[model samples]
Target: MIGIIGGSGVYRAEMLEDCKKEEIATPYGRVSLTVGSFDGKKIAFIARHGEKHSVPPHMVNYRAHIKAFEILGVERVIATAAVGSLRDDYVPGNIVVPDQFIDFTKKREYTFYDREAVHISMADPFCDEMRAISFKVLKDFEHKEKGTYVCIEGPRFSTRAESRMFKSFGDIIGMTLVPECQLARELGMCYLCLAMVTDYDVYGEKPVSNVDVKRVMAENIERIQRVIEQMLKELPEGRSCRCSRALEEAR
Candidate 1:
């Protein structure tokens, strides 16, 4: 089964049919997710920031979220995030499938194996196979294929100085992807991020006057939805990648 993690303006996928809400419990905690079927395939969807958008990025229970998917028999996760563009090439209302991630987030539980001290390799954070699948679906849309995403710790947007520093290091910036991505890896689940470019950050000389969050999200909402819809339709029937085999060395 496939899992979808919704972020920002995306709280739900309208295409999901026969949707039912599920409350799941894991060793970490309990998480609520929506389950439904699309094209005869079972899918699970979770709103990362909660259904009400009440939780901030730093406060998200990353472990519980991934655990919910795991317990539900989900094999792959497609995470969507609203990000700030560090480069002009990726303007507002654009979509990017990041090939790499630099985690600047602090104070979040990054792993599940605390007692056993398991070390999962994270040299390539996002699953390449899942990313490739996402890329193939996104190719039909007007979006960037590959870029580096910098995940920061935040309920606040970056300052001008911070934005510039990030631009020097990566192509895009966002919060909430760090522990989410890392935790999924520890669970041996394939993960892919569909980062939606929502703003230029404070680095842009536009004075940061009127970057309307609602407006930007409204403008790109349909395109983002479309990409995910296409991705669901094209998702492979069985795992042909190493993501499902990630836990072979866990013991």
Candidate 2:
């Protein structure tokens, strides 16, 4: 099964057919996921920020989310996130399949092996095979294949100076994806981010404004829908990568 984690303004997939909600219990907590079929393939969808968009990034139950996917027998995950662009080339209303990530989050429960002190390798965080398939699905779309996404600890957006500092190191910025990506790796699931650029952040000369979100989302909504549709259509049934073997070295 393929798992889809939806971000802001994307709580549910309209393309899903015969959808039914399943509330699952995991070792971490409880999670409600929507199970449905897309093009005869089983796909599970979960809203990372809750169904009503009430949960903030720093408060999301990353453990339960990943655990729920694992319980559902999901082998691969396509995570959609709304982000702020740090680099000039990562413009607003663009889609990015980030190949690297830098985490700046603090005081969050980032691991599932706290009791046993297990260490999971994260040298290559995102799954390469899944990333390649995602890029191929969006080949004709205005997308960037390689970029470093900086995951911040935020209920608040970054200040101009902070944004500039992050821009010096990364190409895009977002609140989620830190523990979410890492936890998926720990659970042995193929995870890839489908990052949607919502703004240029506060460092841009044009001054970040609240109005840009609606504008960017509206302009790119159709494209995002198409990208998800195409990705589902092309997603493979079996995994050939090492993502599922992540726990082999855990101690």
Candidate 3:
């Protein structure tokens, strides 16, 4: 089955058919998601934030959510995150399929192997096959095929100095994607992040605002939905990437 994790401004998967609410109880906590079908393919969707946007980025239960997907027998996951642009060219309303990520987040449960020392390879974090599909799907829209994401701990936007420092190496900024992406790899699930640029970071002339971010995402929500639908449809039945073999090499 394919899993879809909807971030801010995305509350539901409108394309789904015969949807039903499911509550999964994991070791970490319980996760509520929707199980539905699109084009006869099984799909499970969970809003990263609550349905009403109640959960903050830092407070999200990443482990439980991923665990729930595993329990539901999901193998591939497509997640969307609203991010602030660090570069002038990665404008608002643009989409970025991040090829890399920098974790600046603190105080989050980033792993599932707390009982053992399991060092997993993260040299290439995202699934190459999924990224290739995304690149093709994004061709009809304004997007960047490659970019680095800077994941910060928040409910708060970055300070100008912090934003500038992140800009040195990262292309986009957001509050999630650290532990969530890594945790998926631990379970050998193919994960892809479809990062949408909602506004410019504080490093830009205008300070980022919640209102503006919401406005931008609301306007571009349909674009993201379409990309996700297309990617799901294009994916082959069998996995061809190394994502599923992640744990075999971990020590």
lDDT of 1 by residue, 1-251 (tens): 88999998889987899999989998889998899999898999999988888999999999999988988998889889888889989988778888888999978998888889687777778888777877788776778888899999987778788888899989988888898887888888999899988888788776332355556877888888888888888887987878776778766
Give the per-residue Cα lDDT of candidate 1 at 24.
97
lDDT of 3: 0.93
lDDT of 2 at 38: 95
lDDT of 3 by residue, 1-251 (tens): 99999999989988899999999999999999999999878999999998999999999999999999999999999999999999999999999999999999999999999998888998889999999999999999999998899999988999888988999999999998988999999999999999999988897778999998999999999999999999989999899999989988697
Q: Residue 118 of candidate 2: its Cα lDDT?
A: 81
Backbone Cα, N, C clashes tallied per candidate: 0, 0, 0
After superposition, candidate 1 runs with Cα above 4 Å error: 207-211, 249-251
lDDT of each: 0.85, 0.88, 0.93
Error (Å) of candidate 1 at residue 12 is 0.8
Show pairs that collide, candidate 3.
none
Using all chains and alpha carbons, the TM-scores for the candidates as numbered come to 0.95, 0.96, 0.99
The superposed Cα distance between candidate 2 and the true structure at residue 211, in angstroms, equals: 3.9
Candidate ranking under TM-score, highest first, comes to 3, 2, 1
Find the candidate with the highest TM-score and give its number.
Answer: 3
Report the candidate with higher lDDT, 1 versus 3: 3
Which portions of model 2 show Cα errors greater than 4 Å? none
